[model samples]
Target: MRYIRSIYIFCSIVTSVRSGASELPEERELTTNFSSMSLTKVPEGLTPITTTLDLSYNLLFQLQHSDFRSLSKLKVLILCHNRIQELDIKTFEFNKELSYLDVSNNRLKSVTWFSLAGLRHLDLSFNDFDTLPISVETGNMSHLETLGLSGAKIQKSDFQKIAHLQLNTVLLGLRTLSHYEEGSLPILNTTRLHIVLPVNTNFWVLLHDGIKTSKILEVINIDQKSQFTSYESQQIPILENAKTSILLLNKVDLSWDDLFLIFQLVWHTSVEYFQIQHVTFGGKVYLDHNSFDYSNTVMRTIKLEHVHFRIFNIPQESIYLLFTKMDIENLTISDAQMPHMLFPMYPTRFQYLNFANNILTDDVFKKSIQLPHLKTLILKDNKLETLSLVSHFASNTSLRHLDLSENLLQHENDENCLWPETLVTMNLSFNKFADSVFGCLPRNIQILDLNSNKIQTVPKAITHLTSLRELNLAFNFLTDLPGCSHFRRLLVLNVEMNLILSSSLDFFQSCQEVKTLNAGRNPFRCTCELRDFIQLGKYSEGMMVGWSDSYICEYPLNLKGTQLKDVHLPEISCN
Candidate 1:
C-alpha cells in the first residue's frame, strides 16, 4: 500500500527538480512546504539541473523511481526530514551525475544494490533496517568512500558484505551496533573498525579478528567490555603504541567475571577513562577478582559513573587505593549496596562522588565520604528508611539534585516518610508517604518522579511544587486528582496505568502548562463524562489524553489497542 505512495512522491520531486522551481545544482531542498501536494504532474520540457538538492522538512510522503528522471546533472541529494520510505537506482537514472546521497530520517527497511550504485558518501541513518542486507556482491557501490550507515540494522551478513566493500572508513552509532547477534559479525577488510558490543566473550573474538586483519591501523575506541579485551589479550603488541581510550558505560552489562577481566586488561596498558552507567545488574557481578599490580598500575583516569555494586562486608579500601594515583572527576557510585568506608578518608583529587543508591540505615551517616573537593552529592534512590542520614551532607552546602526514589522511608514517628528540602530534583516515587510529605520538600525542586506508589489522590497542597517542571505518577492507585493549575512551570505529567476515570478530565484541563500527558493503560470508563476526557486528550499537548485513538478505553467502551488520539468521538457515542 505504501509503496505506491512513495513512488508517486518521487515522481513529483523529480518533476519539480527538473522544472527548476527553487531546486539547486547540488540537490539540497530546505524547509520547502510540499505537504499533501500531489507528485502526479510531469512538467513539460523540464531539464538541465545539477549538483546538490535540498528537499527537507517538506512533509513529503514517499519517493518513487520516476522522480529523478530529469535530474541528469545532480550530484548530492539531501532528503532528510522527509517521509521517504524506499530507494532504488531506478530513481537515480535522471541524476546520472550523482555522487553523495543522504536518505536519513526516513522509513527505509533495508540497504540494497538497487538503492546505492553511483556514490561516495551515503547517509542512511535513522531508518528501520533490522537485519543485514541480503545482497552481497559489492559492485553496487564501487566509488563509495565514506558511508554513514549508523543507527541502521546491519546484521553479520550485512557486515560481511560491508567488509567485502573494501571501503577505508565509516562512522556508525553504538546503539545500532549493540543489537548484533551473539556470535555473528561479518568478516572485515578494513585495517581498523569501530566495534561496539557488550562486555562478552564474543567481543573478544571480534577484536581478535580485527587484529588478524588490520594490523597497521590506528585507534581502538572501545566501550565498557573493551576494557577487559585490552588486558586479556597478547594482541596489545599490535595496538600498544596506538592511542587508546576504553569508555566504561556504567551498569549496562558488567558481571563479576567481566569486571575483573576488564581490570586485568587495563592494569598494564595506558588505557584511559573507565566510565560506569545507569543500568543495574545483579550484586554477584562484583564478587570475583583477578590479579593486578598493586604498585605499578599507572593508568591516569578512573571514573565510576553510575556504578551499582553490592559489597557489604568486603574490604573496599583496596578499591579506593587503586584510584589514589589517578585523577578522578565524576565519581558516581549509584544504586548499589556499599559499605561505609568506600569514601576517601582524606581530601582527594576527585571533584564529585554520587553515592545515590544505598541502604542508608541508622549509623550509616555518622561520618561523611570526605571528598573536600566534592561539589555535588546525589543520594537519590537510596532506601533512606530514616531521615538520620539527611543531616550528614547538610554541612556540605554544595549538594544538588538529591533523588530519594523508591525508598521505604518513614518519618521519625515511624509512620510515613516525607520529601526532603532544598534539593533540585527530588524523586520520591514508589515510596510510602503521608499527605503532609509534600510539605517537607522546599519550593526548589524542579523535577519529581512520583510514579508507581500507593498515593490515591493528588493533594491540593501542590502549590509548593511551583518550581517543578516535570512530575511522573504513572502506575499509582489514584482515581481522582485535585486542581493543578498552580504548577505554572510544569511541562510533563506522566500518569499512565492509573485508575483515572472520566471525572478526572476536568482536573487535567485545568493544567494548561502541561505539554505531555501519559494516560494509557488506565481504567477510564467510557461514559459521557469520558467524552470530554477523550476530547481534551485529543486536543491537549499531552500525548495519551490528547487523542481518542491513543486513549485505550478500559471499561464500558473497551478499545483494547486503539489510539485515542486517532479515534472519533462521534463513532463512540458513550451512554
Candidate 2:
C-alpha cells in the first residue's frame, strides 16, 4: 500500500513536469532547506543566488544583519520553531525581493520593523507580543496579503492597526487567550479567518464577530464550556449575516439540540461546505421526522471525522434521515466507530460517500436500496469479509470508484462476482485475496490495486481486462512480474517487495507499453538476465522508480548488497 501511494505521487510529479509547473533546474538549485539541523548559528558560505532558505526548528536564539545579507535574491525565509528572541531591523534590508517571511513559534517579545514593503505573507504567531507587531503607522506592511498573530490577550485596540488592510487570510492563534474584547475580529477586512480559540473564554463573541465579514471561517478547540446555552437568539442573527462559504469546526463539544441549531443556521446561509472533526455529541435525545422537516440546505458537502455520540441512543435511521434532508451531494464520516448504516428511507442526493475505518459488514447493504447517483463509495478498513455482497450492492448504483482496502475480504470460489458496468477504478489492497482474486475482478476496470495481498501469480485468464492501465501487485508472493500480454494498455505496474529472483528479457520486450515500473526490493540473482534488466532501466529514463536504492543484489556471495546500477557483467558472459 505504501508503494501504491508512491506510484500516485510519482504520477502527479510526472503530470506536473508535463504541465511546466515544476521548478526549473536553476530555480531548484537555488532552494536551501536546513530545517531541524540543530545549529546555533546560521551556516556560513550561504549561496549568494539562494532564492529560498529554511532554517526552521533549530537552536539559534538571534539573527544578525550579516546572516542573510549576501543572499540578495532570497524570496522566502522560514525561521519558525527557533529560540530567536529578537530581530534587528536591518536583518532583511539586503534582501529587497523577499516576499514571504515566517518567524512563528519564537521567543520574540518585539521586532523592530524592517523595510518589508515587498512582503506579501508574514507570520508572527506564537510569539510574546501582547499587541500586534504591525501597526497602521507601519507603512512597510502596505502590500501584505496575509498575517498571523497570537498572544495571551486580545482586545479591540490590538487590531486597530491593521483594520484598513484588505488581506486574504488572518490566522489568530488565541489558545492561551485570557481576555478578548467584543467586536475585535470584525474590524479586519479579510476573506478567510482561521482562529484557534482558547479553551476557556467567551467563544460566542469571537465567533459572532469572526463570521460577520469573512468568506471562510475555521474555528478550532471549542470545548464543553463554550457549547451553546441560552444564547440561541444571539447566535441566529450572527449566522444569518454570515457570508462564509466554508465553515470548519474542530475539537468541539455540543449537544443534540445545539448540533441541530447549527445545521439549521448554516442551511439558510451561503455556506456550501461544512466540516466537523473531533466533536462529541452528548444528551439522550431521540429525534423524530419533525426534527428534519426544514427545507433543503445550500450545503453541498458535509464531513465529520473522529466524532463521538456520548450517552446518546438515537436510532441509526434518524441519523441517516438528518443528512438525507440536508441534500448534501458529498458526505464523509470516517473513524467514528460506526457499526452499521441502515438504508435511508428516502432517496438522497449523495454522489460520494466515504465510510472508512469502521466495523461495517456485508449486512450494511442487506437492506440497501439503489443509490442512482452515487459515483464513489469508500468502505476501506471495515469488517467486510464478503466481496459478492458489495458487488451486488454496487451493480445497482452508478459507482465508478470503489475502495475496499484494509479489510478482511477474500475470494469465495463458489460465488461468482459481478461488478457495476460503470465502475472504472477499484482499490482492493491490504486484504486477504489470493491468485483466484483476478478471475472475479471487473473486466472493464481501468485501475486495479491489489497490493498487500496473498496472491502468488497472475493467471493467464486476466487478459480479459484489456482496459487496465495501472496495476499494483506489490507486497505479494509473486516470483516474477506479470506479463503485459494480460493487460495490453497497462502503463504503470508495481511489483516491489516480492520474491522474484531474476528479470527476464521477455518481460521488457512484452511490456513495452509500460511507461512506469516499480520492481525494486526484490532479491535478485546477479546474473546476465539481471544485468540486462538493469541496462534497460538505465536507458529508459523515468520508466523505473526507486531504481538503485530499492534495487539491490541479495544473491551470489560476492555480489550481495550491490545495487543493480553498479553490477558488472562482461558481454562474453551474457552471450
Best by TM-score: 2
Which residue pairs overlap in candidate 2's backbone?
Answer: none
The C-alpha stretches of model 1 lying farther than 4 A from their native spots are 1-242, 247-272, 275-314, 320-327, 332-341, 345-363, 371-383, 387-397, 410-423, 434-436, 461-463, 502-510, 525-532, 541-546, 549-575
Q: How well is each residue in 1-575 modelled by candidate 2, as lDDT tens digits?
A: 00001000111232222212146345443767777799999999998888878788789898987999999988878887888888665689889989888787788778787567888978777777766666544434788887877787777776777777889988876537777777788778888888877676557667667767688888887765654556744245525566777788788787676676667667767888888888888775533434454564577888888878788766666776676556578888889888887555566667888899888888887886758888999999999998878888888788899999999999876777878788999999999999888868887899999999999988876537889999999999998777787788899999999998887555767788999999999998888877778887778887898986988998887999999888888889899
Expressed as tens digits, the lDDT of each residue in 210-272 for candidate 1 is: 334432222223334444433544233323432334433322544444554545555555444
lDDT of each structure? 0.52, 0.77
TM-score of each: 0.46, 0.75
lDDT comparing candidate 2 with the true structure: 0.77
Task: Tally clashing residue pairs in candidate 2.
Answer: 0
Assess the local accuracy of residue 174 in candidate 2 as a C-alpha lDDT between 0 and 100. 53
